[model samples]
Target: MERTARIDTAPADAPLPDGLPDLAHLLDGMPGQSRRQDPQARVAPPAAAAEAAPAAQDRLRPVRPWRLLPTRLLPTPRATPFTFAYAVVLAVTSLVATYADPAVVQALQQGSSTDVAHLVRHPVLVLVGSALWIAGGVLSPYTLGFLLVLTALERRVGGLRAAGVFLCGHVLATLATEVPVGVAVATGQLPDTSLHRLDYGISFGVAAGVGALAGLLTPWLRWPLLAWVALIVGQDLLSSYDPLTSWGHAIALTIGIATWPRLRRAVSRTRH
Candidate 1:
């Protein structure tokens, strides 16, 4: 009997188990083996999807505050004491005008020959009663815009200065436009019948208020407002319809713009 020494026959990379012989089984258990994909398993998205991912994220992201409800975009940001009172006056006057006898309302609005004659004589009180009076039944939009602009100004500057600006614009605009019409009637540029036109409305005051508010606004805002106002006035001028009202609005807006510097200073001092 002769003793036989055993010799090993295996690859250098893998040691064979004493009983191992199948390479196929070993290949199946390797880390790199490709298994049939489970239909539910997440796979990398296609190129198109990857490209759209950022857009989806942007849509999901919360909106920035500046892009949301900004204060600058809002009018009458909050109820102001002066604003409330002013609104009340407008509302009350509007109601009175709405329900009043048509004849009486017309008489009050158009300034009868007697009223105009008297107002012209005084000149001082011409804007007194008419400032709050809306010739056309009290409109909600008029009230709303008036309230917003007036409130914003009252909130920024004290009521006194706001009042001053309002009066300056209202009284000045009234005297400037109406007096001309009166003078025109006197001068014969317009018929004496024109003096009796229904000229009463908050439009003058509202225009002034809007002008003053624009003055307080940031430069970006101020320009747009002025342009918008200019557009309305320009349109009226070009169309050759009611040029007087447009001129009045322009004059009032100018007064408001001029008062801007002082209004700003007052607002600054208020902060201190």
Candidate 2:
């Protein structure tokens, strides 16, 4: 027994860890050749690397069920007619005013005392001339185009309803335009020679009417139209600065937007 113990102790420097499993030997071995390797062996993923991946990506990548909607559920186009008619009427009236008699033109252009006196004396002629102008102006290229556009729009929204909307918008615009002119005239800030027949008109107001119609008819387009109206009015106020030209459209648009709900209700009631 003493000789056997002596041999074991003497073999400490020799290779004596061949068959038995040892924790130090296993740890010192390369990972691939380690004795602990098995079918169930797994290395934990690095904590920083695992946390770096996006968790929400899986949820975000899934397709939505409603994305396959059809295109036919949309409103008819409104701009096609509205723009055409307004331009035509505005142009023809401008042309007729230019080519006619100087006195009549002056009477139309400047609402001065002298011009007023001249028109009063030629009331019949003025009325006849205005009538002809309206006829020609309405049929002229500019007015005709607008009429074509408005006519189509009217077809979509019944004539009476369209008229009401247009008229309401016009009234709002007219007030914006007329009130300023009235104030200017009263204050004598503008020269008597500068005022014209079209000064009190509501072109922008009509635009608001058209915008409102487009907005209400096409639900998705409503906010955009409102934004457009706001921008246009704001620019007009800031730049060209005509209260009526700049702010009239805004007022008309507001009225038109308000009227949209009522108009829709009325149309619904009528349909029933």
Candidate 3:
């Protein structure tokens, strides 16, 4: 019995551990060794792994449900006829202002002043002209912003109403900003030089149009627009670089928000 026990049991520190199976030896000893898998079967990849990989990828990728994008955001513009005309004027004025000789610049810019004298002396001329004027400087960004915003505006309130918002922003902002200077000039508070300061751009009207159009958007779109516009206005104010420009923007923003009541009615009527 003692001799049999010694033959059956091996020492603990010897080559093979007591309980562990001899897997490598079993594989080598098996028949049809070419077909028998040493690695594939022993360390097979999980069945779930192959299936889960693609599903995991699908879960990670986002899918958009709504198909119609532009048609809804931008239906046909409000004043199709006038919008193009407005664009043409901007293009022409931009060309002439940027490229024309001194004489041409003077001729094109003649009525485009928002100066105190121009507003007071020939309010209609300056107001209307200034709205149409572009410095013909900084073409791409301004033009793109112009096209997107003006087209969106026209789409919302019709051409005529959009025009009204624009004119209101332009004329009102001009008056609001310049009137103080005019008063200061009269009271000898500021030199007449300040009154004649050259201010030429379509930014006031554009800002107003942008504001009014924003009123027409759903909350999702509207909130982002408001945030961006606020950021811009706030930055300009903080910089203290351009008071007149900043004041005009604030007035334009206010005017745009104020038009919400009337514009909402118009939007409701159109929808119905």
Candidate 4:
């Protein structure tokens, strides 16, 4: 005969039978119960999430238009020290050229000219001195171009590089144009007086700076600038008022264009 099975009931907090977990222990190990009982049991957010929170907050902050005006008009020393210092020197030289006696100004310009004669006698002195004066003094359009182009370039690639670009165009273009004249003079094809022709100015350097800066600009801006420069230089060439200098401007601009690949790499590295 089969007998009915008998079972014993246990309380909610009672100990378990042999080899089994206690009722209270099983309940306490559940996710919700464990989190409630143990404050340190909470799962932490990911490292990426923690980092993104501040950036999100920053994006929501408002910017003031008025606060940017001063920065746009006058950049900090750290941002454009080379441009500031160079502009100051040019301004002072412009003033001297304007206010000084004609005889003194003529002497200074003659001494500073990067002509074949001065270059032969003191290549270093004249190469540097020639750049100190603007051909048309303070009001020259080249002066404005110099300030704008150089400031923009220096802000991107830095002061040393900007100076190098300017000097590269200045010295190389000067040599390229003047060397031929010197050779012609020596070979008797041109007059000996050609060696002493006045050629002091910052025009070539400004031209090169414009070209280099154009490479760094957006396509819309860059093409217009290049076309404008070409138009101006082309007109000068057609007019033939100073063919040698105009050709130098064209050469210097080409030199700056040749530097585009390197300048792009430099700008990329700076951004990273």
RMSD of each: 18.6, 21.3, 16.5, 14.5
What TM-score would each prediction reach against the true structure? 0.66, 0.46, 0.69, 0.75
Model 4 error, position 263 (Å): 0.8
The order by descending TM-score is 4, 3, 1, 2
User: For residues 64-106, what per-residue lDDT tens digits would candidate 1 score against the true structure?
Assistant: 7887443433333253556567667767877867788988866
Candidate 1 error regions (>4 Å): 1-79, 111-118, 122-125
- Model 2 poorest ten-residue lDDT run: 68-77
Q: Pick the winner on TM-score between candidates 3 and 4.
A: 4
Off by over 4 Å in 3: 1-79, 136-140
Q: On a 0 to 100 scale, what is the lDDT of residue 89 in model 2?
A: 52
Ranking by lDDT: 4, 3, 1, 2
C-alpha RMSD of candidate 2 = 21.3
- Give per-residue CA lDDT, model 4, range 93-162, as digits (tens): 9999899999999999999999999998999999999999999888999877887788888988989889
Candidate 2, 29-68: lDDT as tens digits = 2343333334465665798547644553444466765653
- Best candidate (score: TM-score): 4
Deviation of model 2 at 165, angstroms: 2.1
Q: What residue pairs clash in candidate 2, if any at all?
A: 81-149, 84-145, 84-146, 85-145, 85-146, 85-147, 88-142, 88-143, 89-143
